[model samples]
Target: MKLYYTPKSHFARKNRILIDALSLEVELVDAGNVADSTPEIFANNPLMKVPTLVDGHQVIYESDHIAAYLVRKFDPTDSYQVLTNDVNQLNLRAVMNGVMTAEVELIMAERSGINTQHLKRFDKLRATVTQGMNWLENQADLFPQQPSYAGFHLICLWDHLLLYQMFQLKHPHLQQHIEKLSGFDCVVKSTPL
Candidate 1:
């Protein structure tokens, strides 16, 4: 199996952590800078997105779908509960994805020479991120005590936020959770370059 990813993408980082945590023997292919059109990613994914997985004749795109596929294929019993059946975990995952989407949009806009602070859509995007963060803070107890799928997503998002300096997250509970898992080998090995 081959997983196409960019080192700095929070989306790709989620899968990388999962692969490492499960000790899956998958080839990691850097898709180059996603900011530009990359033929390699485009060949496997029509959308040209990172976190695309190629297993034999099957091609998978989208980070969440790829994660589900990985868990089902490599860890069918989901011993790690990386892809849980719990509603709270599923909802948390959706919220995290929303925040990630908003961040990516704001980043792309800023890179295109647009002053995001002056645009209404950008304002909405910022609001989405803030709302997501607020929701996560309120449901802090739902966070897993161990490193699971939702926990990995939160860690990846937190790292991305720090990397881009896009938002100042002051939630103590979330901070504590991240700090506790910071030393996990899966996280340590997958730290973005």
Candidate 2:
């Protein structure tokens, strides 16, 4: 199995952490700048997205799907429950993904030399991130104290936010939740520098 990822992508970070947590023997391939659409990434994923997984003849794109496939295949016992059946955690995970998408869009736009503040679409994106984060903050107590898949997703999102300085909202509960789980080896190893 081979996992193609970008170093700075939070989505890739989630799967990287999962790979270590599950102790899977998969090759990690750094797919240079995603924006450049390297042939290595494009060949595996038509969309040229990060966190693309290749297992034998099967190719999987999208971080969530790759995580699910890995958990289902490598972990027959489902010990980590990476694909959680819990509805609340599933919903929280979706919201975290949304926030991540919105923030990534904003960062990409800024990097493209676009004045995001002047665009209505960018405004909506900012609102999506802020509102989603606020919701997550309110539901912080619902998150597991241990390093589950949903917890890892939330940690990745929070770390990305900090990495980009995207928002300044107060999320003390979420912060504490993340801090509690930060000592885990998988998380420490996969954290972006």
Candidate 3:
């Protein structure tokens, strides 16, 4: 089995954390990205993204899909995955997805050094991310009692916060939410950041 990914990518971090926690051993290979329009990227996935996996004639793309597939295959005995039979875990996945996108958008925007024409949109995105973070912090109880899919999602978001951290300064507010999530040991171990 071969896991093709770049260590520097956030999505790749998700896959890597899962790999670490599940203790799945696979041959590591760096497929880089589709920037130069690599043939393997197009051949494997039209998206030309990192973190693609080659497993037994199966080609997997996207970090979330790859993580789930690897867990299902390598850690089948573990029923406490993020997307499992549990309804709460599924709901957590949904919540996390929203937060994850907000984080990604904010990070990408910040990295560009300017919001430019998208000022209103950037402000809106920042507000939405803050709102989501506030809400999650307020309702920490909604997370499952056990480490599961939602747990992974929260941890993944935390990882993104540290990695991208679009907040330049005066962003101590998000830290409260992050601190709340960090209370979990699983979050510490699973988070790549």
Give one digit per residue, the lDDT tens place, for model 1 in 79-130.
6577677998889989999999999999998898989985889999999999
Task: Provide TM-scores for the models.
Answer: 0.95, 0.95, 0.70
Model 3 lDDT tens row, 1-193 = 7877655455665666667666667776767542546757433677776778888899998777887788777776765563466665465555556766666666655666765345887677777667676666656666655555555556666666667656432234434445665655545654553
In order, candidate lDDTs are: 0.88, 0.87, 0.63
Flag regions of model 1 displaced more than 4 Å. none
Better by lDDT, candidate 2 or 1: 1
| Model 3 regions more than 4 Å off | 31-43, 85-87, 109-118, 168-193
Comparing 1 with 3 on lDDT, the higher-scoring candidate is: 1
The lowest-lDDT stretch of 10 consecutive residues in candidate 1 is 35-44
**Model 2 backbone overlap count:** 0
Native-to-model Cα distance after best TM-score fit, residue 105 in candidate 2, in Å:
0.5
In candidate 3, the residue pairs with backbone N, CA or C atoms under 3 Å apart (3 or more residues apart, or in different chains) clash, namely 82-149
